[model samples]
Target: MKESVSYAPSRADFTGSPAVAASSASDGPSVKSLVAVTLGNGLEIYDFAVYSFFSVIIGHLFFPASNDYVSLLLAVATFGVGFIMRPLGSMVLGNYADRHGRKAAMTLIMGLMSLGVLMVAFAPTYKDVGIFAPIVLIAGRLLQGFSAGGEVGAATTWLMEAGGHSRRGVRVSWQMTSQGGAALLGAAMGAGLSHLLSDQQLYDWGWRVPFIFGLLIMPVGLYIRRQLPETHSTTAASTVANPALTLWREHRRALVLGILLVMKGTTTFYIIVYYMPAYMVNTLHMPASISYWISLTAALLTLLIPFWGGRLADRLPKRKPILIGCAIVSFLLIWPIFATILYGVPLGYTIALIAVDQILANISAVAMFLLVLETFPKAVRACGMAMVYAVGVSLFGGFAQFNVTWLLKVTNAPMAPAWYLMFCSVVSLAALVAWRERHHDE
Candidate 1:
């Protein structure tokens, strides 16, 4: 008779003792784990930022048109196309992460992101392949959208769970910090390339350099992510069941509120930070290099402020800082800040205003992410966060630049983006207030 095989959970299969898990999680993540997870996030953001900063040049190469404005609009539209795939990516990958292990999901998405970056990096321009060029570009952007859809949820959850309940605010802050770093790096690259290359040279070939550089970093990101410890091990068995349905049935309220809250962050980020350089160049007629540098400065401030905001979230009521940040954005600063940029203020003044705007934005972002991290249980945390964030970004963040451009063109109002930002802030503030009250009752 053949010996019967028996299956048993291994040590790695177990989520760790409750006491041990709690102790380790609250104590904060080791530098190794933090760096490993965040590196992938940075890579993802770097790819997106590179695309945004170079959209004008890319427009000429991929979607040449008789009219310059139309060509640029097409390129921006292509950029938004990637966002369209985000919700679907979120559903599939988010569900996978919730069902499988965070480590496995994270590793897989990094590889997917790498493939997308490679597609864009190597795609032939319209001159080389005619219609196929734009096709290739759109395909790559869709792949990236899919990969990114699930990235934030998996990464943020990993950081939060690893950080423990107590220090989750500080721990998850790295998610935004990594993004800010990517923005800074992307801006610096654009600025350097703009300075070194003639306009024709940049349009012809220089734009592809950043995409290639992003591909080179993929292996490093993958290797680092593979070494990360799993945080959702506690839900290993339970997660095998469908999490998406569970999330909708049980956490629908949280999901809706989460999306609303995320709208403000995504809009503010895309508009103020990512879109600033383009706005300066296209609308304000600033030198591309100077615009890139100004954006780099704001990105640097954005990177620094989050750590402080995270620390404050740890010490104070998370909602207070968030509310204050929203108030400042909605009621006081948005109009004047945009006015400064629109009216052709001195470069130093514009940069200073941008820095202050980013600081307030970062504070609200840190508080919001921390709140979301704490709201969901581990079993469906990754899926829940991914779905909400992806949807919010798809609707608001993805189209931010497109909307701003359209608004400016149709209305011929320089303050169009500012009004949009203020509107989003007000909506988000209402959602935050509701969320705070709901959690208080619970």
Candidate 2:
């Protein structure tokens, strides 16, 4: 089941072989690799998070409707439209990475993402352009979704390969950290804008600022990514014409398990990290400013806490037990936690409760991530990871906000999120128990 030879050669191995040392040196310094991956991935996630953070205003501007609920629903639905392109992107771009090189795919992804960001940044309003505004906005989201589809796979694969097996845990952990950092930055901007701008101002022009800022930063990320040395070994031989085909034929079980494993993390992450602020404003009737601040706190926790999760993952002998523990505890606690929030808890208590959910989420997410990486050999790493992640995220994470919004609106149930998370936990735990770990750090 293993590839003929390992794709990730250690630093020592690189230095010991003259040709390899020369090639590895060409790959750029380790610090540069880290920087490039972090910057590119962070920007993609930042743009995505910014859109979610400002979805309400975006709904008003581009998805204008008579009813506020309908408008917001349309906006979030467009957000979901982005997910429609994720699987295609994963197959195309991921196959390219598997064949060509991670560096090339990373560079290409940056260009695609930058274009998407630009579309969203200067998109005209529905009032100004009539029906064309939503069309343009939806196009931008689709492009962004496509670019993001390949981004995580290429970036995480590069990190794991560049850092070697001994350092895989911390390096791969950076992928989650970058996402958290992006969300943190987005939350801060959201809070700052809500504090400074009036509702009318935010509705008119303020929502576009983050996308514009992301566009401006794109060139710098593109430049850094271009400088990265190729991580996929050129000497490795594979006659498989299509990485996706190889994956489906040889690794179908891993693919299924990976998707199921990612479901819990992706669903919980979108709900808490992206959807919570809106939930506070619309459902709990909290002030927009307070909601953004609360979101800021959650983002900060997400950015800082996952490193601990990564380190713990590195130290653990088995990922399954702890992962199961996290899921079980989550299933048990989610209902009561939501009940407490619905009962009008104090601000501090609410923040604490959200923090609890995040901690469990971060730990289990990191553990599952490493487990998935090890489930496949390097031959199909990029496409394998990309396909599963894209499918899982598209199915669960993409429409999570829309679903919860619809659930709460239709059922008049305050605990809709809790119900959703509990169900995800059960599914994830079942997948974890069925997963057979076939590889480990060598």
lDDT of each: 0.76, 0.77
Error of 2 at 438 (Å): 1.7
| Candidate 2: residue 7 lDDT (0-100) | 36
| Model 1 steric clash pairs | 25-163, 25-164, 26-164
Would you estimate the TM-scores of all the predictions?
Answer: 0.86, 0.87
Give the candidate number with the greatest TM-score.
2
Instruction: Give Cα distance to truth, residue 423, candidate 2, Å.
Output: 1.0
lDDT of 1 by residue, 122-171 (tens): 88999998999999998988998899899988888787667434455567
Model 2 lDDT tens row, 305-326: 7666755665665667778888
